[model samples]
Target: MIKRLTKHGNSLALVIDRPVLDLLEIDDQTPLSVTTDGKCLIIAPAPDEKRRQSFQSALKKVNKRYGRALKKLAE
Candidate 1:
């Protein structure tokens, strides 16, 4: 299905339909993370608390193992 961006003040907003929202398990109370890959946009339900913690922990270990050089490259 196709969606168009509607005018929202000075910005554009895409209206997500109900079926897509349901498939993503996005309830009104849940938050979403919005990001872009330069060429495209991504919208997803935020990871749960446990999963977020695990990801941050794993990232710290990896950064420590790689030292500061890898982090510099990311910048």
Candidate 2:
């Protein structure tokens, strides 16, 4: 889908269509990461706070289980 870039004060913006927004599971207030790989553009929704916390907790658990190994490796 093509979207025109319009002026918004000092910045330009492209308004995504509703269907596309639904497919991307993004709402107006959703946080997103945008990047360009060569000529292609990438847009992805930022991880949810709760999900991020869960991942951190899981990582901590794994680190604790392997703490002795990690300490040996560090030495």
* TM-score leader: 2
The top-ranked prediction according to lDDT is 2
Q: lDDT value for candidate 1?
A: 0.89
RMSD of 1: 7.7
Query: TM-score of model 2 relative to the true fold?
Result: 0.60
Which stretches in model 2 have alpha-carbon errors above 4 Å?
Answer: 52-75
Give me candidate 1's TM-score against the actual structure.
0.59
Q: Please provide, for model 2 over 1-75, each residue's C-alpha lDDT reduced to its tens digit, 9 standing for 90 to 100.
A: 567899999999888889989988899899998899999888889778999999999989989999889989999
lDDT of 1 at 73: 90
Write down the lDDT that model 2 would get: 0.90
Residue runs of model 1 more than 4 Å from their true location after superposition: 51-75
